[model samples]
Target: MNWLNKLERKFGRFAIHNLTMYLIGGYVIGYGIYYLMPNLLNWLTLEPGMILHGQVWRIVSWVLIPPSGNILTIIIMMMLYYSLGNALERTWGAFRYNVYIFSGILFTVIGAFILYFITGGFIGLGIFFSTYYINMSIFLAFAASYPDMELLLYFILPIKIKWMALVYAVMILYTMVRGNIAVRVAIVASLLNFVIFFFSSRNMKPYSPKERARKTKFKQQSRPHMTYPGGARHRCAVCGRTELDDPTLEFRFCSKCNGNYEYCQDHLFTHQHVK
Candidate 1:
């Protein structure tokens, strides 16, 4: 994590902002190619055999492979992934988000080559590696960050993010269990980023309804108990404002102060510490 922090500090400025838009655009272009020149897709696929035979472009071109054949499915998939991807960018900043996505792609590429070497050129029947699971990694990060967030499943039934994540986890588990060696390798390779980031990053801690309630209770209990002469709950030492002034105003006691001195939200960080 310290290394990641240092890397972020060093290269954060170069991080591409709004990277999800470009990814969706790539999908659109890929769909266009799929429709117009369907035969070209063969050359663009991530085939290690093809690459070994002098087709170097497959390394990058394979990223543009459309995840689905149906137009509606592609549209919905793009929208869903865009939403999750942008949210992750906002939460982690552009650099970390880019690292996560690119790491998945890198791992998938490595997995493809490894498969090629293992199987002696017959990697799989179809495009072995794709961005499908890279997009899935975005959802995993979203669920980890906002486990309590809910969505209307199919625009009717309400479901929490964590529940949906659980469903995806089960599906992946089933695929790994029943799938062939190629399929299993592909799934694990694509999801390696999520596995690495989730384990390495402390922010990906598991959250549940019980954990949420416990955190809320602890926060409420941890608040300082101070009483003014007029039965007032909180009074800012600087501006002398009380709960009677504005019911919504937050007050926090300054730790640096010699005695009990509180400040409202506006001055909590800006106010000088009492010596």
Candidate 2:
């Protein structure tokens, strides 16, 4: 996480925010393929009717497989994932984004483990990643922000991203109904994180009052200070008031005049200012 600080200083908020989400997601997928796949495959394969002997790694590897793969498909998916994920990170900030992602992963992992114990082994759990529900949290965030944003389907017909998201959700339900019980449970498990993290989080203030004040102060400090059109002034020309007198007050450009001015209570109406 030290690199997170470096990234924050170097590339600013959006860069580290985005990199954080992608790193978490990419690590889960990469680790699954590198370590879990071999261990799980000894028990089962892609073909139907394959048997799994409750390999522990299978519980985790199931999250890594993408629903589909092709250069075009992957490009489209990656673009959508990045766009939604970054949008969420920007809207919710770094801590919330991390919570959303890790919470979903944790919920799915836990549900899988429970199912493993109940069934005495990993079985019929292919539906977790088979549908896009695992990634729905990102899409849900995007839909909340730009529900009316239009997207082309099959690159031919136009449709709103929100409506498409709704349709995708329905498709998930349909697939779950038509799929195995384990698959259905896994899909629910994947989405349960959304309910637990975001729904309940509506009432959960992640920041303390002190932290809120600190963030507000930091934002004000980081923002570019306003100045006059001509030259910087230490005191208000109209009222003879110095900036040091009221440090919190900000001076801005005057809409009615050519130069900058700050008005104390005595000459407050004498100038028009823009923040």
Candidate 3:
């Protein structure tokens, strides 16, 4: 997680904002390609065996494979994934969201190659390694972040996200049991990011904006007031402003400073530390 933070600080600007649009667009283009030239998908799928035989483009082109052939199914899939992806982006920021998605893709690619090697390059896992599980990962993350959020199941019964996630979990387990080696690999690889993120962030709580604001307000109110020589309390050491001067100014003690020095939010990260 520290490494992720470092990477975000260095490459956050390069993250694609609103990445869900591109994913949906890819599916649209894939569907068009599927309808026009169905055989072309054979060359575009993730076939490591074929890649060794001079079709290297298959590595990236595999993403062009539509998850389903049914029009209605694809439409619903796109809409559901788009909403989940957008919500995750807003919750985790663009960089982390990019990492989650890109990592899933990377893992899927790795799994394909591993399967190819294990099976002696005889098996082609293109069909198994679709964006279906990647999209499922997004839903799992959204459910974890907003467990209490409800949605209409088939536009009739209201259900919580946690319940949906649980159902998906059972489905994945069923697939792993009944599916072939390639199918199991695909499912695990695509959802690996979700597993990694859930464990890595076990200590951290995902809070909604309102809940975050409430927590901040509570902390501010409960902070012990520091008394100064002139009977001043809640003062910023750098700005030399007390709560009496500006009642709205929040103060926090700097852990890096040698002594007990407080700073306002504006100067908390920018002010020089005491020796």
By TM-score, the best candidate is: 3
| Tens digits of lDDT, candidate 1, 195-228 | 8887866653323334556777767774545667
Candidate 1, which ten residues in sequence have the lowest lDDT sum?
203-212
TM values, all candidates: 0.75, 0.56, 0.78
Give the whole-model CA lDDT for all candidates, comma-separated: 0.83, 0.59, 0.85
Which stretches of candidate 2 lie above 4 Å from their native place? 1-16, 20-64, 122-132, 201-275
Arrange candidates by TM-score, descending: 3, 1, 2
Best by lDDT: 3
- Candidate 3 similarity to native, TM-score: 0.78
> Residue by residue across 1-275, what tens digits does model 2's lDDT show?
34434654665534345654454475346445655564543332221223244345544444455545655776677677777777666655675666567667677666655666677665554444322565776676566556788878898999998898788779878988998767776778778856665455454333433455678787676444444333434456576665666666555434565544546554556654544
Mind giving the per-residue lDDT tens digits that candidate 3 earns over 1-275?
77888999999999999999998888788888988999888889898888888999988888878886577867877898899899888777899899999999999999999999888877556778888889899999899888999999988999998999999999999999999998998998999999999876644354353565677777787555456656677778888888778778888989999877889888999998899
For model 3, where is the 10-residue window of minimal lDDT? 202-211
How much is 230 displaced in model 2, in angstroms? 21
Clashing residue pairs in candidate 1 are: none
List residue ranges in candidate 3 displaced over 4 A: 206-275
